[model samples]
Target: MSVALDGVGFVHANGHRALTGISLSAGAGERLAVIGPSGAGKTTLMRVLGAALHPVEGRVAVLDVDPWKLSPSALRKLRARIATVHQAPPIAPRLRVVTAVLSGRLGEWTLPRAIASLLHPSDIAGAHEALTRVSLQDRLFDRCDRLSGGQLQRVGVARAMYQRPALLLADEPVSALDPTLADATLRELVAQSEATGATFIASLHAVDLALHWFPRIVGMREGRVVFDRPRDEVTQEMLTALYANEHTAQGAADSAVPMHLAVCRA
Candidate 1:
């Protein structure tokens, strides 16, 4: 298995319980999507899976090893095999695109080489090649601050690609992109995952896109796994119920598929 979690739970610093009793497992070379409403703990769940946040309860085993049990060096080495693309990539604004993409290797590079990369990007061609997958090769040298939101999102994806990780995790990776670009980018990610036989998982709010792209669908709500089943088994009724409280919390339960979701699904 690429990932295994048993009775995982997490709490925020502010005393909010973000996840509870979340058990999930994914096999190598499998592609899955996590779909949930806002504040449903999707992001928190991804953080736990990525080893960025240790679960306060239960166990987490990625690539068949427990991350929290590993030594510091071993943990870093294990993390190098896993890559994450954040919802809002925490990249420096002033850094050039190529530099940001090359940062993916910081986990694997040596001390001297890592520092040297900050001074001068060590592999311009490699960065460019990764960016090419997202059609951002033309902006390889541009400052990150100069790019639009959608472009920055793509840059994050490119960096993940450059990492060549065994386990890939993405949090709303195409949220800022237009419909066409979002579809194209997701197709690209799936293609690469298939080529490399990497375990790919993404958290998305777009129900249609998640259903169309992934074979396995995991639905989350109130920090719990409401359903874990094959994509074809996910019904419209299930989606409606999953997002029920999200809309009802505001006021009405608008039965229509959300406009924000359609923006990417189209």
Candidate 2:
């Protein structure tokens, strides 16, 4: 298994249960889309799978190595094979786009080379190649701060590609983009992962996007796994029910009518 979670559970310092008894496994080159409401533990699960967090119960293994048992050096080596893109990516705004992309190579570069690259990016050709993959080669010299939100996200993807990781984890990577941009971003992401034969686990809020792009879907509610099935097996009715409860609460909080008018009309 490239990624595996066995009977995992997590409790935060605040005593909130973020994940409960989750077990999942993905082989190389598989794409798994995880979907849920806001508090459904999707992010927590992604953290656990990416080896960023240790579960309170059960175990996690990536490429046959126990994630929690690795020493600092070993852990660094393990992380080189896994990459994560969070909802709000942490790209340095002041850095040139190429420099930001080169940071991905730090995990594999020697100390001196890494330092040299930081001061003056050493692999312009490789960085440009990565940008080309995402159709951003022209922006290689631009400061990261100047790119639009969608372009920034593409830079994030380019960095991940530069890492050449065997496993990828993405959390709501396109949620903030407009519909057309979101679709295009996701298509590029999926295509790049496929070209590399890397396994992917992405947390998504858009059911339509998941169904259209991913073959496997995992639905989570609260802290539990509610369903794991092929996209063909997921019915619209199930998704409708899954989101209805959350939407109902939101609707009540932001009532359609103005409060004063509602009171007067009543």
Give candidates' CA RMSD values in order: 3.6, 8.1
lDDT of 1 by residue, 97-170 (tens): 99999999899999999989988999999999999999999999999999999999999999999998999999
Please report how far candidate 2 places residue 154 from its true position, in Å. Answer: 1.6
Pairs that collide, model 2: none
- Which candidate tops TM-score? 1
**1-266 per-residue lDDT for model 2 (tens digits):** 88888899999999999999999999999998998778999999999988889899988998779988999999999888888877877998998999988888688889999889877899999999989877799999999999987788878888887888899889888876787877777777788689899998899887666766787889888888888987767665556555667885334223321332213120
Which runs of model 1 end up more than 4 angstroms from their true locations? 248-266
- Name the lDDT of candidate 2: 0.82
- State, as a TM-score between 0 and 1, how close model 1 is to the true structure: 0.92
C-alpha positional error of residue 7 in candidate 2 after TM-score superposition, expressed in Å: 1.0
Worst 10 residues of 1 by lDDT: 249-258
Best by lDDT: 1
